[model samples]
Target chain A: MITLAVDCMGGDHGPDVTLAACRQFLNHHPEARLLLVGRPERLQGFAHERAEVVPASEVVGMDEPVEAALRRKKDSSMRVAILQVKEGRAQAAVSAGNTGALMAIARYLLKTLDGIDRPAIATQIPNMRGGATTVLDLGANVDCTAEHLLQFAIMGSALVSVLNDDPQPRVGLLNVGEEAIKGSEEIKRAGELLRAAAARGDICFHGNVEGNDIFKGAADIVVCDGFVGNVALKTIEGLASMIGGFLKEEFSRNLLTRAAAVVSYPVLAALKRRMDHRRYNGAALLGLRGLVFKSHGSADALAFEQALNRAYDAARNNLLERVRTRVAHAAVLPAAPDMASVPGATPPSPH
Target chain B: MITLAVDCMGGDHGPDVTLAACRQFLNHHPEARLLLVGRPERLQGFAHERAEVVPASEVVGMDEPVEAALRRKKDSSMRVAILQVKEGRAQAAVSAGNTGALMAIARYLLKTLDGIDRPAIATQIPNMRGGATTVLDLGANVDCTAEHLLQFAIMGSALVSVLNDDPQPRVGLLNVGEEAIKGSEEIKRAGELLRAAAARGDICFHGNVEGNDIFKGAADIVVCDGFVGNVALKTIEGLASMIGGFLKEEFSRNLLTRAAAVVSYPVLAALKRRMDHRRYNGAALLGLRGLVFKSHGSADALAFEQALNRAYDAARNNLLERVRTRVAHAAVLPAAPDMASVPGATPPSPH
Candidate 1:
């Protein structure tokens, strides 16, 4: 049976949203088991044959400082959930808690894989091709060198390969333009490194792609530093939210428009389904020694269940082994500082 | 009278679009006069009392290399249009031509303004507050220092002040988070510089904002390096296009959906008109000695006319003087190398 650890007392809704999702997730995946980690009082009511409650004393606040969560909240539900993965009791762990705190705890517990300097957040954004394009470093490692970018590309490739079941997924270096000479010096150098990796058969480099290319489905995987990736991701969220608000206002302005909205409900619903964020809720924290998935902090039960589904799939597919294999094959990666030895390394910024 | 030069032979539609836009623009603004620059053969057929034909021997192709457009096409329509502005015959210039070529030619001819290291493209994105937020460095300087970012904030303030008539526009430094400690070193330094500028009463600083803040209308102006700005801009375009395509597909799937589309036509049209990119076509190339506005290459007559309207507005409101006043008053800006003396400066990449 595939086992997953759940941070039950996490996210905006805490036990209310996560417990409901866990019950639904357990019902759907018959061969899967869950270790529900949270305050014993909160999770006592959630009892399932395939699920067991793992007691934790504290909960990480949505706006808690990373340092405080990492150093002070040693018994946080977020940490206890990841500890399951480190202890080999669970194949994967999923959380909807403070992103920075989660990443720090995951890194501290699982450490990073060999040849991987930083663990990146990989998520999917729906594209025009009726499929989602995988993008990496969504909000981890804000300042990245060319080597870091190259590593992101490799990690993204491995993740996409498993998600799409494609042995060789195409990777695109996110840049200002398609030309090699375009973008910052770091991006240009990353492009050269990616091309070299392609020559060595470590990745299938699709050259440089613009931000719009992420939605255009220009490549299966698009990689960039955390800052740009975060901006692009949030920009998409903002525009989509604006469009939603505009549609609602337009359809409710008058009696005639209200009737029109009723008539157009089916088409509008289809559009909404196509662009639903919940369907793409899970964000994999790749390059860590253990698999961890993050759900949006404000996710409902349905979205939280999607995150559980992703972690389950990643575990079953042996995603960590795939990443290790890809990183090992690519000999261009430079040696990185031992993160475990650096006690005061900068904490990751929240997504 | 507000006199503007038109690159009539530029963009994909060339005279077919620009000439038609010129005629319509003249009818709308009685006080505006246009200097239409293009080959004589194309200009001979059109005549207007307020608009004069200026002869240019060549046109810059959209995909032509920046170096070729700069060195080989001296008398190109794009060049002639800017020449009118340089010669004091016109207050501003408008083009729907090759972006990189236009920027290179404009910079080489007009030179950078004192205290400005690079020219940036500033444009508006529709925001949730039923207005628009002005963003700068859309696709100019790929790499930017804290000083360059501060310069962009000042330049953006001047542009928005003219566009909105707000004497003190609030400027936000775009970053991953609103927290002061959240982004890259450059972004952090930029935040500090912006705060310093605010203390000196040079700008109204709104602290750090995320990409969503652009649409949230959290600030009147948002500043970032060109790479991030370009990515944000193109990502918006791509998503908008995708949504448009999806709506069309959903509304045409079957007879039932088709009837529903007919019923919802008015509401749908309202949404389309609100989000139409044509209304926001003109992007001002700021930090130049003279005002130059860029329209989308594929713009139709209506969109091209909007570009003319922007240039006229900027000229009439004395945008250059406002920029000069802001830059001169700000004591933090470091002196830039004389662009005129740098004979072999790198050409701008295409927007």
Candidate 2:
């Protein structure tokens, strides 16, 4: 049976939403087993044939500092869950707790894979082709170098290849414009490295793509520094929310519009279903030795279940092994020429 | 009567769309006159009492390098149009041409205003509150320092104060997170500068805002480096387009859905009208000695006319003088203590 570790006390709703989601997730995946990590008092009575409770003494607050959480909360649910992966008790770990603490603990415990400098958060976003595009570095490693971007591209391409079942996924470098000369020096240098990597047949680099290309299905996998990717992702969420508000306001404008809304209920419902972000929950923290998935902090039962399913799929597909092999191959490629010596090349620093 | 210079040979559609827009614009604004600058052969037979054709020998190709367009194409229509503004023959200049060429020429001719180090491209975006937020540095200067962001805030606030008629427009510095410690060092330093500027009554600083805040109506003016701003703006455009394509596909799914679409036509029409980007076509290039507005390259006649209307409004409202006054006032604020000595400060380089 495939086992997964759950941070039962994480997220805004805590054990209530998580426990309910675990129940639903267990029902759907007959071969799946779960280790629920949280305070014993808070997780009382959660008994099941396929599930076991791992006792923990503390919970990571959503707004807690990474240092405090890492140093003070030794027995926190988030760290305990990640320990399951480290100890081989579970194939993967999932959390919706404080992102900073989660990354810190994951990096400290599981450690990064050989040849990988840092891990990236990869998630799926809906695209125009009725399929989803996998984007990486969602919010980890805010400032990244060309080398980091090259690593992200290799990792993202591997993820998409397995998830989408495409052997040679198209990898796109996100920039201000499609032209090679359009973005900052870091992006331009990253583009050069990606091009070289493409030459070695590591990935099918589709050249530079603008932000809009993420949703336009211009490429199967889009790679960017965490800052740009995070901003782009949140901007999409905000715009979608604003559009939803606009639709509601217009549909209730008058009696005639109200009747039209009734007639269009089915169509609108389908659109909402297609655009629902819950279906795409769970961002994989790739480049680490073990698999870890992060769900949105505000995720409800249904959304949490989706994240569980995503983790299960990654484990079953041998995603970690795929990343390991791809990264190993990437290490063999000749290092890209030093960009620092190139005029105007601004080497990125960590945030 | 207010006079506007028109780069009649700019953009993808060229003089055909621009001249037609001028005809319609003149009909709406009886007090407005147009000076059409382009090749005289291409401008033959245009005989409107309020419109006059200024002969020009060359046109800047959309793909031409900015250097070539600036130095080689000295007598180009785009340059001639800006010359009208510089020579005091026109109150404003409008172009639908290449953005890079236009900005380079405008900056070269008009120069930046006193106390302003760089000009910013500011445009309006629809928000959930049924109003628009002004976002600046769309694609002008990619890498921006804290000082540059502070300047953008002051200039954006001044523009909004005049256009929105609000004495104190909330100015937000766009970042990855709302927390003070969330983004890169440059963003944090920029936040400090913004707070100090706010203390001096230079702007109504709303503190750090995330990408979603741009559409959440969280602030009246959103200030960001051009790289982030451009990416965010284009991402919005792309998502909107993808959603539009999705609606069309769903509404035409089958016979039943098609019939429902007809019944819901009015509601959909209202939604489309509210979301139409054409209504917000013009982007003001602020901080220049003379006023200049840029329309989208693919703008149709109606959209071009909207840009013309925007230019007229800015000229009437004295946007240039307002920016000048605010910038001058900003010059006296004690220069933010040099942050270079601060640990973890990444000094931003001009891109």
Candidate 3:
């Protein structure tokens, strides 16, 4: 059975969405089993023979402090859920609760990968391209150096390889330009280190990609500091919402436009499904010793189901081991300066 | 006549798109005067009398170092065009040249405002609301502190008021959450400072906004550091391209889908126009002592025309003066802090 731990009391929608999602996951994957950790009352209604309820009366609210909240609420559903992963009681953990809380408990419980100083929250973002781009450290580490960014690249590369099933994932350093000297002193230095590593022919290094490349999948793995990653993630979110708003305005502009949407409904529906956050809900807290997925707080059942799929894939792939091995190997290896000549480095380093 | 300087020797597309854009601008706005700056030999044939030729024998290529190119090539179109802005020969300068060169010149000539450490490239990004959202620091300072972010918030708000004609345009700190405490320590510090500023009514503050807010037009102005801003900008570019790819793939799915696109062309056209970067080509170097505009390096003639309009607006509105006046006023005569809550604790503290 693909066992998963569910943070039943996490998220804005809380138990309602979590319960529905668990049921949905079970329905879709008969092999999937859940250890629902939350207030028994919340996880009680939909008691499945295959799903067991772990009593946890507390939760860290969306607004609570990360450190204090985690410490104060030892029995909080989010923490209890993480503990399941810590104890190896479940292969993966999923939470839609406070992200800070999730990250903290996951770190405190599961511990960081052997050499990782920090564990980054790895999430799939809708890129300017057709596929979702994986950007890490979206929140986990606020202040990061070049060495940390290098580790993120290694872990991210491994995650992308497993998730996308790409034998050699192309990794790009997220920056303002493709030029080596572009950005801050740190980013410039990071670029050099990344190039040095890429030269060894260990991982695919696609050089520098800008914000536009995030969505374009210019590289399977885009690494940056948390601040930039957070901004990029939000920017993509802002753009998606902006486009959604425009479509709504356009379709509502006139009866003709609305009629046009009906005729184009199939294509539009397909497009929406292709871009839907629900279909791409789970974000991996990469570099962790175990798998922990942070779902959007407002995620509905469909999104939760998607999270389950991601968790399952993650568990089956032994993602943690892959990341751990790659990171360990990358840490000791010499720099690969030769990857600068990656076939696609010219006018369009758009990422 | 509205005289606008065009850097014919700039951008990947160079004079081909640059000349076409200039001629088109002149054709559309007969009263508008065009000063094409480039190699006299290359520009003389295409520009004729409608657009006067400004002899610039050298050009800045995409591959060359921005500073090196600017320093070595005294007669380069990029330098000459910016020089025109400095000399007051042109009300505004337009360049598809090196962004680094334009920013350097603009900063060196225009100088930053008294309280402004760095000027930012502010652009109106297309949102889902069918209207545009103004995001700043598209490419300006690569590294910024919390204090710098505060300045961006202030400047971004003023730009929105002038550009969108909104009364006290709501300003949001681009972050991963709507909560005041949802980002890096820097962002949190910035958020606290923003909250404090908002309490004092410095500018309309709307707490934190996520990436989706960019498209949703959640706020009139979204403020961030240059590093984050660059990532966000490129990410949006990536998303736009990705959507284009998705549409292309979806429409090519089958013969029936192709036929449907024919019927759906009008709606698609309207949506595409709303999202087009050409309409928002002009990027004002905000916080500068004087007004400066940066066009897309690959900008065609249509894009150049839009840039001209942005420049004219900045010039006519005395945008630089307005920003200066507002900052001077806000910084001066410190308004009473939010003393309504506490009578004992003084607000005067150290940064």
Compared with the true structure, all predictions reach lDDT values of 0.89, 0.86, 0.74
In CAPRI terms, model 1 is classed as: medium
Q: What is the TM-score of chain A, computed separately for every candidate?
A: 0.97, 0.93, 0.91
Better of 2 and 3 by lDDT: 2
For this target, which candidate reaches the highest TM-score against the unseen true structure? 1
The digit string of per-residue lDDT tens for model 3 on A1-351 reads 778998888888988888888888888888888999998876778868789998888888887766677678888888888888888889999988777677777877887777676777778876555577788767665567777788788888888889999868988888777766666777777887788778865578899887776766788888887767766676666667667766677777788887777777788788898888787788888878889988888888888778878998899888988988887777574332321123211110001
> What's the C-alpha lDDT at position B54 in model 1?
96
**Over the stretch A39-101, how does candidate 1's per-residue lDDT look in tens digits?**
999999987999999999999998898889999999999999999999999999999998888
Q: Which scores better on DockQ, 1 or 2?
A: 1
Second chain only: TM-score per model? 0.96, 0.94, 0.87
TM-score to true structure, per model? 0.97, 0.94, 0.86
Off-target runs (Cα >4 Å) in candidate 1 are: A336-351, B335-351
Model number with the top lDDT: 1
Give the per-residue lDDT digits (tens) of candidate 2, residues A292-316.
9999999999999999998998899
Q: lDDT tens digits, residues B1-351, model 2?
A: 889999999988998899899999999999989998999988877889999998889999877877799899999999999999999999999999888888888988999887777788999999878789899888787767888889899999888998899988999988777777767777888899999888988889998887888888899999998888888898899999988888898899988789888988888888998898899889999989999999998999999999999999899899999988898887674343433223222111111
Which residue pairs show collisions in model 2? none
How well does model 2 score by local distance difference test?
0.86
